[model samples]
Target: MLSIRAVICTLTCLLFSGLALAQATPRAPGLTFLYSLNCTLGASLPVGAGPNGNRVVIPITGGSFKGPRLSGKVLPLGADWGLIDSKNTFSADTRYQLQTDDNAHIFISTSGPAQSDGFIHLRIKFETGSSKYYWLNNVIAVGILTSGNGYVAIDAWQLTSPTKA
Candidate 1:
């Protein structure tokens, strides 16, 4: 049998722990509109089935992007090495370059799985040394990709703190 003092202490600890957990609960992050990319593509070249999945390489011919912060054109040198696994999920893996209208070069990579809504959800990343657009290097971004007859469109947003104004 526990002592009354021990019982009271345990109850107090449990109550404070519950209160701590309530205060620690995390809120969902918010998103800020980042950019939109519309890219033309060449034909996809099938790479046959590999150990992980069926692979294809789709060339990114050319395109453009616009946003409140920056606008640019997609260079012609990029490709998407996408894969389809046994579960029939398409995983897009792409690396590309963007040339801003002002001539700063930015490199971008996006990877994510296709969802049930027929949209490919993307994790977008960026790299550049230009002082004007260097903020892209630190953002956590997401995108929704839609494919058309000969091109692909991506609408991207940056993750933000819920309290961000």
Candidate 2:
């Protein structure tokens, strides 16, 4: 009878543990934050001195995109896009942040010429009335980028997240 009770207790604990992990897991289907050399993107991102924040989620094994849902009319990834020195889709390792309001954000890191700091990536997802915007910020840095050089040099910008359908 004691063994039966123990098994039941263990299973119960396992069930609760799984629930906790699920709640903690990040909402999958990551989104991308695009930065333009020009300000015509028409998207805006407001960075608040977030709460006593300390933890960051650096994606190690996942794609940088969740849903292609975007807004504010995607600036042609061609001559209209400034981030690209030339013209094309550049797949770079980026990062993002989440505010207390539950807005999903993505970021990228960059450094000026001849500097030795990592880059930054900031991704944000927001819905305003009937519009969805994505704000992707990139900070320039030295060698590989990390959470330290992640938060600094944030260049604020926004893109469409997706339609509510």
lDDT of each: 0.95, 0.31
For candidate 2, the per-residue lDDT at 80 reads: 11
Candidate 1, number of clashes: 0
Candidate 1 local lDDT, 33-105, one digit each (tens): 9889999999999998999899999999999999999998999998999999999999999999999999999
- Quote the positional error of residue 101 for candidate 1 in Å: 0.2
RMSD of 1: 2.1
Q: lDDT score of model 2?
A: 0.31
**How far does residue 5 in candidate 1 sit from its true spot (Å)?**
6.5
Candidate 1 residue-wise lDDT at 79: 98
lDDT of 2 at 165: 31
Per-residue lDDT of model 2, residues 1-165, tens digit only:
479889999999999998998784453342334322211222212222223222222232212222234312212221111122222222232332222123433322323221134343433232233223332222222222223221222333343334443
Off by over 4 Å in 2: 1-4, 14-27, 32-35, 38-117, 122-165
